[model samples]
Target: MPSPMVSIINVSKRFGALQALDEVSLEIPRGAVQCIIGPSGSGKSTLLRCINQLEPTDSGAIFLEDELLGFERKGDKLLELSEGQIAGQRMKTGTVFQRFNLFQHMTARENIVEGPLRVLNRPRGEVMDEAVALLERVGLADKSGAYPAELSGGQQQRVAIARALAMRPKLLLFDEPTSALDPELVGEVLAVMHDLASTGMTMIVVTHELAFARDAASNVVFMDRGRIVEQGLPTTILTEPTEQRTRDFIGAER
Candidate 1:
């Protein structure tokens, strides 16, 4: 059998007195849309950050395509990667956060082209052309010339998605992507995400949008207090979870 695209092995992270993650382990298959649901301070965002290597893990390890992330093994010792090496490893995954995090001075097209042009050192013309196509993919082709400040919350988020895609990452991670948007604007961003899922992009989304999870996700994972309560098919996990904690959390969410 082919190995899973992402293998998280007994991963643990702590923030001073707080145990942010408690030996969390998961396997994400390629082309799967996985939704992680939990309450506030449940370590959902922290987990995403760990996957992206934005936060250094306290213990255990994460592997992407069977290669260790954030560390290299020399002899028996596991040495943490330098900042430059970590940046190279991080390019394999794209992350979209609650905030759009765009450059205010740059237009949407410029924002999308920056990574490939600067970091990967791809040709400017080629990257720009790809940027145009990515903008169209996210339904923002017409807004490519607009600045983030000029766009609505939904539109800006769409651009953010496009920017992430420009890097051609193997995995995409989202942390409460729609939490910052107004209620009415949430659908537009979710619509883009749904379209991406249809294209078989390997995505791990941390969200409270149960409707989206039920309709688009292949698997749903419920977590609480730094541990996974349960995980299974959306129909099973969302509709008839086994754990009492999962049931209680689902009840509160509904």
Candidate 2:
């Protein structure tokens, strides 16, 4: 494939006495859906945070395009960037979380447009139009006039997806996006994600939805104890996982 959109090299993160990640290295190709799954505290979320520079690693490097995301190594030609520099790069990526994180005071339309209007300094008409279009895409066109309190858990998460899409980001990262939804509502959110996958947008996800990961992701990564246990085509890893740990993990989940 062309040079990966995101590259991680010998990356590690430590929290006090605990090592959250250990020499993790991977290349994420452009326009593909990739998911990382493991038990809790397996460094899944930390790895996600490190990618967007939300958390600084103790060692190793991340590259988004030509720019180093964070993590400086000694004697490595130090092209370290400032927070503003990184934020500019980060705007090219959008994130949606398990928690909706919507603005209680604003309507759904306003919540979606607030970031673009303030951060990108976009024009009101353009922002509004984009917000409406995104809402329609997420199946929340009618919910635009409502506030978070007026919507169900699934609806709020859909609005959050619309809010993220409003930025017109080059990549989208989902962190356990359906973990907070009710069982009945999870399918709706997953359906939206499946539709997104069909569009071939580059996406990286940390999710527990194994079936969704198998069906929607082109690649699946199994992470454990701060390391990648296995990475391969979803079909192989999901149906015929090679590692004993992979089989054990899936069995425990089942």
Candidate 1 lDDT score at position 182: 95
Model 2 C-alpha lDDT per residue in residues 1-254, reported as the tens digit of each score: 46787888999999988889999998888888989999898898899888887888777888876667753445856556688877887788888887978889999999899889998999999888888889999998888899899999999988888888888887888999999999999998988889888887888999999999888888999999999999999888877999999899888887
Stretches of candidate 1 exceeding 4 Å from the true structure: none
Q: Encode model 1's per-residue lDDT on 162-213: one tens digit a residue.
A: 9899899999999999999999999999999999999999999999999999
Residue 151 in model 2: lDDT: 96
lDDT for each of the candidates?
A: 0.93, 0.87
Best by TM-score: 1
